[model samples]
Target: MPDNDSIDPTEVARPSSSRRDPEWLRARLDDWLPTVTGSPATITRLEIPSANGMSSETIVLDAAWEDTDHRLVVRVAPTPDSDPVFPTYDLDRQFRLIEHVASTTDVPLPTLYWSEPDPRPLGAPFFLMGRVDGVIPPDVMPYTFGSWLTEVSDDDRRTVAGTTIETLAMIHSAPVPEELLDLPGPGETPLRAHVRRLREFYAWASQGRAGSPLIERGFSWVDEHLPVESDPVLTWGDARIGNIIYQDLSPVAILDWEMAAHGPRELDVAWLIFLHRFFQDLAEMAGLPGLPEFLRRDDVADAYARSSGHEPRDLDFYITYAALIHAVVMYRIQSRAIHFGQAEEPVDTDDMILHRATLEAMLAGAYWAGVR
Candidate 1:
């Protein structure tokens, strides 16, 4: 595995268990270049970021095309035998969704060139898009580091933070194309849809094993307080700092859209705040200037409400919902690694520590929700 800080972005692939090595990926690119572009292409170097968690094998490839050097990103899904918990949606849909936003809004994002849904190409679904240059610090990778304030000047960090929030707002505000998204039937509430889908995720995780008490508690709270909310907004499921690329202390592009869907406007806000909380203590950290000094959760909710017609109330319920969703997601990832054989086992001693800490947080969150 190449060190993210030291690696030549052109020469390495993310060494996660799911993705292929640089050699294998290079060979594939060499084989496909002529078919797609009608010209020979050579992948001079391949490097993958290590942050994507069961979402996709995202990589950056530096290649030469007709004597011109270019950087391209490939988003590839895991192998089928390595069954995933949530049925993966089409990358073309994600590409078109983001592309649609770019066409309509001022949201900065990587341009999409092509998307191949059939696994016949790489033994899994893959898509190619223009690469944006930036460095994602490890501290910014997990939401828990939200408090490890950036060394960059406040103005620059705010620019990065503002770009993310603004882009999300743009995505939330953009008129969703019905044909581009596989939405639920007409008149369905997005909140209900999320709850139902999450329940299904838990069911899959607990198929042969006993359910986690933490999950049961969280699920009960979520079911009882189901928002029954409806809003015409595009919700990016895994909206977090890690997904956005920062260049010169500003976000150049918003990266992952694999879990995007149509949902209540608050869902996106709650998800963003939840993600921020995982990294920073909102009460202590000043998220983005020109915004309130309070937790970004409040700022995000207020910002979205002010921009859109709908406002987010019962913030606790939504926050709890976010925690539950992430808890379940993390647990499922561990379950996949531990039982499903989809992920490579961790040799690091801290793996178990992190898992325990995650569960503790989940359970504590569930406990608090019940108390509330």
Candidate 2:
């Protein structure tokens, strides 16, 4: 594993600075918690995590309600001034989806409290849930660089990877809520609709700016090689071990519902596989071992097959699609970084994507052959 000093700061994604003031948020919560809890409440402590997401803002607070101390989390939609990552954030929809999933499925999730959709109290729509305490694979240092995940025994790491696949099985098996469908319009397959949305997002992200030729070609490739449609299921759009909160190598709370949608099982499966490879590639580029054996594509496919009793097919298409999806998001993120003056505009727009080489290799059908 690479030491902290050896890791280039610019290579990692930086967390966005807080848009709302801490005391201001505490005051608002003090005034607002009573209305929802039906009792007077006082905020004892409040903090915005340094590891807060680049998209939505996360507020962690300890409050006294009815003489009981509550450790809670607030998922707040980004204010308009913050230059949000996605075009829109539907906190209410996400809250309702979590509620439905919790009620119907055994998939572990944080205990949801209340969703404030009005955006009047907190300067944006926000939802509250019980705080889950556990380890999450660090994205800043790229977990593979050095973390509990890298320090664990191979057996323990295997348990973590296997159980995460089982969690994916559980999530896919859950009954889909109508609102979560995100169904395609007439005559469009779910996979096509998914790629269509990605195109639209890329357009929005790169509007009025120099767009990526690589991303444009990726879109074209996706259109030419769209696969035979499979029955749609609820896919955790941002599927990866990093999104999961784990204790003792077991997932306790599966978080981050912002990207939840209905799509083929392979969408989630490929994402889980590709994301780890993304980080693993970063580690190798830095001349580190980086858990090469972890989340192997074949191992992930076989594990999902055994867990779900449904074999994954057309992975070449889906995995490439996953890389395409990630490239767009990374482009948006880098765009945001440039907007914030944290990074300078590169001579080539493709330089904005941290994994440009990986995506290019995947496009050329040369990536997997070199994986082993």
Candidate 3:
């Protein structure tokens, strides 16, 4: 979840663009579904979720097809006028990536239905998948603040963490298709290439706005401490508990693959760890204990090793890199907010990053000393 330091959690964060009309979408679906399924389809209900993501727009729709009801999710690209977070929205790539992972691995994934590359139907490219019924950790108040995850026993939380790691291991073990390789050119290491991409994204995001000094320093620190390259694998780019759908304390399906890429296993592992820490730190800041013991760095590393037979190495660098990546994302989100008039431009652009202090601590090599 991107940190919104000033925005109230009770207020849902969405782009300032005009809301998509549910009735218009229902009419479009009514026309489009029959062409894809080869059967007449009637959309009974079409709703824009209240908690739609700041990036892609998720549509929850119920329809009658072949005399049976179907509940499905449609992930539509942000309209060009919405000032999308990422520069590009490749729905086709995301759709194929999910399809590939579902076919090649046992990683829990939603049942995929079809991909619509044409933008005419929804005003943007989108893909359809069966909606899995489960509880997702809320990003608004944050599960760490208080949610089902917090109410569960420590043992249940442990089960959630352990099983989630196993699912990540399964994803990493999937065969990397040739199309997924967007690897570095001849002279670059995968880690370096990854950092380079981050730099590029930051450059694009910071244009026409104040740049964050903390983010610049983070890039310098990464350049100074880049680790020896690890073998790249299929990495679930946004690997975190918040992106998962859980049933009875177990992950039933993994959601959100826009960031899926070819990267080191540590990229995924450290991201999972650092994201929890991000939320935990927020919880503690609010005088809440949070799940301090959940998703501990060392515990996650050990569990990944046990599950994958490959020891995670250089996590300090990787974890810091993870924080830096998240900082850049948060910065971009805040920039969008400012553009949409939801936030003011802070005197110090670093203020855009809610975890600026955390990133600084990581860069100073003092963050881990304070953690167990």
- Write down the lDDT of every candidate, Cα atoms only: 0.63, 0.87, 0.87
The runs of at least 3 residues in candidate 2 whose Cα sits more than 4 Å from the true structure, single-residue gaps closed, are 1-12, 15-18
The residue ranges of model 3 lying beyond 4 angstroms of the native Cα positions read: 1-12, 16-18
Pitting candidate 1 against candidate 2, the one with the higher lDDT is 2
Clashes of 2: 0
lDDT of 2: 0.87
Q: What is the TM-score of each candidate against the true structure?
A: 0.79, 0.96, 0.96
- Show the colliding residue pairs in model 3: none
- Candidate 2 at 280: error in angstroms? 0.1
- Candidate 1 clashes: the total is 12
Clash tally for model 3:
0
Please give, for residues 1-372, the per-residue lDDT of candidate 3 as tens digits. 223355344333665564688889888888999998799888888889866257888899888889999899999988778888888879888889999999999999999999999999989999999999989887778789999999999999999999899988999999986585568768987778888889999999999878999999999999999888679998889999989999987789999998887789999999999989988877776767889999999999999999999999999999999999999998998888888787778899998887777898999998987764
Give the 10-residue window scoring lowest on summed lDDT in candidate 1.
1-10
Q: For residues 154-268, what per-residue lDDT tens digits would candidate 2 score against the true structure?
A: 9999999999999999898889886756788799888888888888899999999999999999998888988886678888889988899999999999999888887899999
Q: In lDDT terms, how accurate is model 1?
A: 0.63
Question: What C-alpha lDDT, on a 0 to 100 scale, does residue 248 get in candidate 3?
Answer: 83
What is candidate 1's TM-score against the reference? Answer: 0.79
